[model samples]
Target: MDKLHAQRAPGRPKQNEQNIPLQEIILRQAAFLFMENGYEPVTLQQIAKICKVTKASIYYYFENKAELFTASVVFMIQLAHQSTLRYLEEKDDLRTRLEQIAKAKMMHAHVDMETMLREANPHLSEEQFGRIRKAEIDIHISLAKHFQFAMDQGSLRSGDAMFLAHAFSALVMLGSRKHVIEHNTPQEDLPQTVVDLFWDGIATQPQHRK
Candidate 1:
């Protein structure tokens, strides 16, 4: 019995053909669960269950639920950054690209990021907090770069690219609010409406604006 236990560790992670690390698989599933439910409500056991791994197997990769939650949120943020880049790269027209990004973002019901982070706050360390913030900023910077390019080309009025990016993000976040969304406006039109509102304000003949 001792020899058998030594040969096969109890916490050995499951393997896959793609060679993706068990850590990544765990992070992916954990991110989904954390995003679906808040950090406080999700447990390492639940994450392990979702990933089809034993709780001890998760412990091999993460120290505790807090560490797992931090990693999961960072993973989710990086994935969002990648998805945003793909959408932005799909079109050249600023309005069209913005609309595409908005539509993709609004397609799902968002767990309010601010609220989620607030819930996770006590569990995260400063380094963990920094990681999440950097990942979130990566998406903003990508959008800002695109906005800067359009501004440089005289396609958009001269203004702060980063601010525009933030404004656009805020406008899209409104789509996630139930009361605002429930107000007569059709769900399908929300993305277009958001883009229109953002564009109309900035798309005025390329004049230098403070």
Candidate 2:
């Protein structure tokens, strides 16, 4: 009986410790599965199996599939926001910073949360969809602030900061596709090439050419 008690006591603490990270693990794995298979095809059972947890365990963290999907979008955007903050802190020139941002976007292209959400739109509530859209807009606003800073520093031409930011983001998004990455453009040179094309078009004069 003493041995049984000891075993049971240890098991509870071990279970608690394991449970602590399960929510995040679920979000990450769910995001990957949703991105890989889209929302319609992915089942809670599949997510539970992949996370080695029961459907009840997932329900403990999220109310339903839509909630889980929304939370996963938030999780991914938060990560990207943190990365953007770190990249913006570097002392590099504007072009270099933009290149790094583009490269980072390329690295994460496989995640494609926006596309996945669009494909799964019918399954999501307006509130859930709005949450994801707001997250994306927040990122765009952050990037626009950076563009405004670059304009002030004369690293880029003076223009509508938000518009420039949108254009730059669109360019990065296009470059992030697998087909674009695998094209004749070498991976190492792609980000730099993208930056050069963007900056050259928006830069002030011949002296701005680099």
Candidate 3:
């Protein structure tokens, strides 16, 4: 982050120094701005103005708008990953853990996926884009192991648990992405629904025999 002193009149008080530095402050604010206005629409000048700093100061830290945008996006991605990891580590049972992982993925999907897709541009390095896909695959691998163990126990139907895991993942991605596209509902609602649907399957329980 480009460090800059408070531009406010000297009367503004030295106590302001206790807050995070201006460059870091701008990075935090930049993430929100990018999410709201998209990375392309938001200019460095605009970010500097919003953060109450000068353009030169922004340059000191980011060098250019693209670098700033990349850093902000990377920060957001890390936060999403940390949140998912935290939720996923909570459960001991394989099935239960898978459910938690699915739920966490859905909850942040709106903020993470939508923003990334909206801001994506051809000029941006695909190398950076590769990180997003790899992180997703890593998450899928972790959850797939649970399915494998469950299959070995015979608690779940036998077959290739790995295939079943992948199939379930595909189904969830479809539902989750569509839910984002169609309803635009909050992320929490649809992922939870998808998880429930997955564990139980969509078929309704048959009525009790007379």
Q: Please report the candidate that would top TM-score against the real structure.
A: 1
Q: State the weakest 10-residue window (summed lDDT) of model 1.
A: 1-10
* Model 3 residue 90 lDDT score: 72
Per residue, candidate 3 scores C-alpha lDDT tens digits across 108-159 of 4443354555566554667656665566566556556667667778877777
Residue-wise lDDT of candidate 1 within 1-210, one digit each (tens)? 455335555656767678888889999988878777778888888888887878878877777788888888888778778889998888567798888888877765557778889999987899888889999888889999999999999998899999999999988888656524475657877788888888886565657759
Model 1 CA lDDT for position 80: 74
Clashing pairs in 3: none
Clashing pairs in 1: none
lDDT of each: 0.81, 0.77, 0.64
Better model by lDDT: candidate 2 vs candidate 3: 2
TM-score of each: 0.83, 0.81, 0.61
Candidate 2 per-residue lDDT, tens place, 1-210, comes to 355334332322123355657778888988878766778888899999998877877776677898898888778887887887778778987778888988887766663555787887888899998988888788888889988888898877798998987888777776776424475656877787777778786556766436
The CA lDDT at 137 in model 1 is 85
Q: What is the lDDT of residue 149 in candidate 2?
A: 88
